[model samples]
Target: MSCLEIMPKLGLTMTEGMLAKWHKSEGEKIEKGEILFEVETDKLTNEIEAKESGVVRKILVEEGETVKCLAPVAVIAGENEDISGLLKEAGVNGQEVAETKTEEKKSDNTAVEAGPKKVVVIGGGPGGYIAAIRAAQLGNKVTLIEKEELGGTCLNVGCIPTKTLLHSAELFSEIKDSRNLGIDVGEVSINWKNVQRRRKRVIKKLVSGVKGLLSYNKVNVINGFARMETENSLTVSKEGGKSEKIDFDSAIISTGSVPFAPLIPGIGLEGVIDSTGALELESLPETIVIIGGGVIGIEFASLFSSLGKKVTILEMLPFILPPIDRQISSMIADKLSKQGVSINTGCRVTSIEKGENGLKVDFTKGNDNLNVEAEKVLVAIGRRSNTEGLELEKIGVKTEKGRVCVDDYMRTNAGSIYAIGDCTGKIMLAHVASEQGVVAAENISGKNVKMDYKTVPSCVYTKPEIASTGLTEEQVKEKGIDYKVGIFPMGANGKAMISKEPDGIIKIIADKKTEEILGVHIMAPRATDLIGEAALALRLEATVDEVVTTIHAHPTINEAFKEAALAVQKRALNSVN
Candidate 1:
């Protein structure tokens, strides 16, 4: 079916409007309700969305052109439809002009072209997979190369598996408290094998879904390790001596990261394992010693301790989760202590040795020797960029501190090559990698973009999940910025009582003069999900009053945000100021 576009009438007296901007260009395919164009009326600019799905065959009135109300402005028709008669009826000679403009759009890369160039992406992590899909959408022939599996570390061994196990642990923890929730019956036990099986299934399903997404985007996938032969050339050597060479117009590297294992005596012992080895545990250990106090360390501590293990964490820093707010970290530490998890901060591990029955870890706390024996030891110190085989040096790609160097545009020193995700070492989170991938792809496809980290949220999957975005109180103090903080406890939240999770609080920091929300930190149930609102408020430069005035859902954890906002001005409703 063919549909003719017309200048929409805004008010009864309105007679004309100026075509402001076209969201979809001529020959662009559009779906129903997609913003097709904007019109400037006497009152305001209004976006006109497509009423039906079709291809934009002709743009009768060019942008900035004035057209009378109810007059034809464009023509939409089914795919490959002849719109010559419609153009003739509208008294418009736009076919030739539209064709020429479309020819220009094809070269620009913002629009789809008939002859798509090649885009070879190394690594099939979140960043690489997303970039592959994006480039494919931009009418580029995208080929994604991976050595082991799609979804990279995040899906195979990192984020997905960790979170899945965390959820299982959380459930078991809840079951252990079933009596308090008005449940009389229960003998709860940690079925570690079943939990591992479920986590594996979830990961397998997601990896398969990622494959489907790549397939849907028409991206070709190669199962092999890829190495840069030159700036524009790559060689992939598959198993059984199979190898192939690929050339590309532009390339992206998102090889992700590997667990950083430092040089320590007996670090390579059978019982000493990194984060990946922790996930592949054959059976639950009765006693465990975790060798770091960062995000990875705390998370594993939470997991094993919840599942009935005597988990001990050793940190060389003054506080666990050093990147988090000091107050929040202390509160979480206290909570973990109450849960039987021993946290040793400012403690440095000197060496690991074979104990009489198990592994022994020797450490120091302010020059005093300390030792802990455990059935298993996990080294969750940190992660480093995994560039073992890509041969970034082959193409003269610059790197800094063991990570590929890239500009704000995510482009490497080589103009045709770009790097994002863990390979660039920017924060090393999967979500961050995904966004950086989009930025890199957009820039390659003729879009002006830059990666921003100001409002990025960090989440830790502890018992009471910790999440924060924007500035921290310490940062404000260091900068000497006058700021005020508001805090609301979960003890007062009705949902918290119903859910039996009234063990945390929400804190909001804002500028004193401007009242703009500068940061939000939460240590509560579902804090990971609740932090999105705070991130958005900070991203939009919204004031505490704006968030306070916005009505939050009744009897929910998110209401803590509103009350916290109100408390910033000493006007909290549910809590006494």
Candidate 2:
């Protein structure tokens, strides 16, 4: 048998590499460790050396084609060897010898002959796709099933598209206040159609990109709805009645979650909609009554209010963003109120009645029963896990409150099964789910891996974005942990002043005993990006003193973090008091 050679990957993260140029073509003689081809990864371009010295008999992939790592790029055989039969057996052209080398090096000690393990992952959301890719990387034959879009809620309707819309709204609000910065532009107007078009375009690109990634990772994507047949098998029904039963050695349930709309009278009314429907609305309503004051409700309120729509937000809770810091949420509420958004907390929707002009929504606020009329009513109460029909019971996997229960390694009760993302119900954030995906993959590959949620950051893409990581003040106080807080107003930041966009603050909480940072919170422009440093600080267990001593770039919003750290020691540089 002739030795076969293939392209090798240089890094762990590289999925595919571009064959920049082939130094040796078919029918060319080559020596061991000689330069055969140059490949380009995202990080760098390098040359692939021939592993075995022989005649280059065949080239599997063309020069310009970007082939996946470990795929056979060329073939080598001994002089005058019978290469035609080898090429045909390896699925190459008859005139060329094919490379039949495996990607992984086989160990000689193992005597057990085992079939390839199959892994089937339900749902193509962030968690499912990530799990699929990771499972494929671990030498498992993987299959991914999705009913609609590849990205599920986060990409199709929830996070990506909504953020795009929120960005547009934020820009519109910023342009409205451009006069304060001596940039005198005329009255600003919004094109809702164009805004929605941009959002749709972003979603389309992200969905396509996700598909490409899955394909590159050699994960078989089945566009269908999957139902559990047994603990180790599932049946997927395609769009045109095509169905297939797939048996797997291991399975991952990552069906994700959906918006939870309360069952109320007139919920099926023409104007009433949920978060998904709200995202699909082609035109903005002249007036809107948003039910619930949670993250989703407030986000839509902020966006629509900035778009010059009359928005009324009613929350069943006593306050909006109840989980966030009370002071920061209150400030945001005040700012939003000043922007003509009506926020009514401690209220519950009782009923809705259709009227001649619009829909009349009757709600109760405290002791007073109030009625409000609007063109549309949006219910943004919350989301529930998509765990129905998953047949977790058969698999011995447990679930609580519509969330799959998993250990730190993201493994379900069944040893071979795992769960991640919203389905696991640990951290609902998308990035957290992606991290869990990696951890699950590593654990499955016999590596000791556990998910770390300590420094997971959360972001709300409102006009002034709110990004936070680690513990909140209320959480620290509830735990009876001795913590000190340092807060710096954005008004003191030179960058905020120059941009005339000082409307938020940064708060840092540190453990008093150890002086290590416990949490970091910020509400300002680009707070999403600025929170990363704080997250790193918490992850590294950096002390408040360390942050204070570190020099931040001058005239930047990031200075607020350093100043907040200084305030922890009662030595702030820009304190007005």
Candidate 3:
């Protein structure tokens, strides 16, 4: 049986639409959800997707022709099947053929003749695997090489694993305060074994899913360490010491970064560990001293403090989370301090020594010297690109301070070579790496795409989660822009009061002259999820008035965002303005 492809009524007042283009010709195969034709109405143009998978048996409407709503535009059925009755129902007199359109949808990438090109990607992290799958989609024979797990550090030991632990810690914290909500539960305690088990389970499931996607995309995944041997070829050394060589038309390097441990006296002591080691610890420590107060440091502090562990953080900078908005960071610092987490800024670690109880860390704050002893000492300063074994210099891929140098197109100095992710030393966030991967794959397939960083949102998963996008107040001031700020404390939000989490705020900064939203910062429940809306506002260059005019649902946290936008004009409705 055949189904009639009707001209859909796209808008409330739309009765007829012009068939601008037909993506599939008669007798051509089309999958469900694939674009079948383009429809242009008086209001807007839309790509109409196929409702069912089959061959286009007959087309009743030609390109640039107008058809009314519910009119049959085409007939879809099995290949070589009879569709004469359906065509007649469409009022197409006995086997009349419609002229096919030659126009096709344009891609963001530079259009080149589609052909089978062999593409090799080194590393299977977020960037490398994404590039491999995308390249394969663009008619390329893609081969991905990974020495370890398929999902790279993020899935194996970094983002997924750490967030899993944080979720468990957060749940424990919530349960401890459940009595305030009229829920009296038994005494709450941390299940270290269960937490670690869940973390491993989530990582395994995600890694397996990545492997399945690669197989589905027809990408050849090689389990081995890859090294560049020539400009066009590389050698892979497998676990059994067998080496195989591969040649490619294009190559992408996304071998990510590793934890960096600072050099200090007795730094190699027994209790000192990096972020990876900290995640895999057998048992939770009674007291832990974490060096560095960056994102990783602060997150770990939140986790430990919530779990009733004595935690201390030492930072060489005057403030923690130096990259984000200082106001948001300061609020998190204050919250952690109230939770009994010691945060010592402007402290320089001098040495680490083993004491009778555990390990002793000596540091200096200004002219004062101090020491803190804990069962475990974690070095969470930062990470550095892992380019040691790639032999990038052999291929003349330029490197500056141990990071691959790439242009806006994610192309390296060497021809046919590209780099992304932590190796490129760009944003270093997982999402940034994934976007760069797509950009590189598109450029390789002859699409002209450039990496844009203007709207990248940063998130920290501490309690009352922090997230921000665009410029901070300090950045705006440095640029000498006249700006206005709108801040709505979560205390004034009904949802916050109902949830007993009213200690955070949402702040939006806008240009004073035009009221264009310049930046958005949030330190509230689910701030990471909320920042996406702000990021889109910045991306579209939307003004505060637009946000204020948009009717937000009542008694929700999102209403607080709208309230903040209103506050920009000194017209907040829910609070005193």
The CA lDDT at 86 in model 3 is 81
Task: Return the TM-score for candidate 1, rounded to 2 decimals.
Answer: 0.86
Compare candidates 1 and 2 on TM-score and give the better one. 1
Local accuracy of candidate 2 as per-residue lDDT tens digits, 492-532? 88998786668999999999988899998888878889999
Model 2: residues with Cα > 4 Å off, grouped in runs: 1-116
In TM-score terms, which candidate is top? 1
What TM-score, computed on C-alpha atoms, does each candidate reach? 0.86, 0.80, 0.85
Pick by TM-score: 1 or 3, better one: 1
What are the lDDT scores of the predictions, listed in order? 0.87, 0.81, 0.88
Q: Any residue pairs clashing in model 2, and if so which?
A: none
Model 1 C-alpha RMSD vs. true structure (Å) is: 6.2
Model 1 has a clash total of 0
How many residue pairs clash per model? 0, 0, 5
TM-score of 2: 0.80
User: Cα deviation in Å at residue 214, candidate 1?
Assistant: 0.6
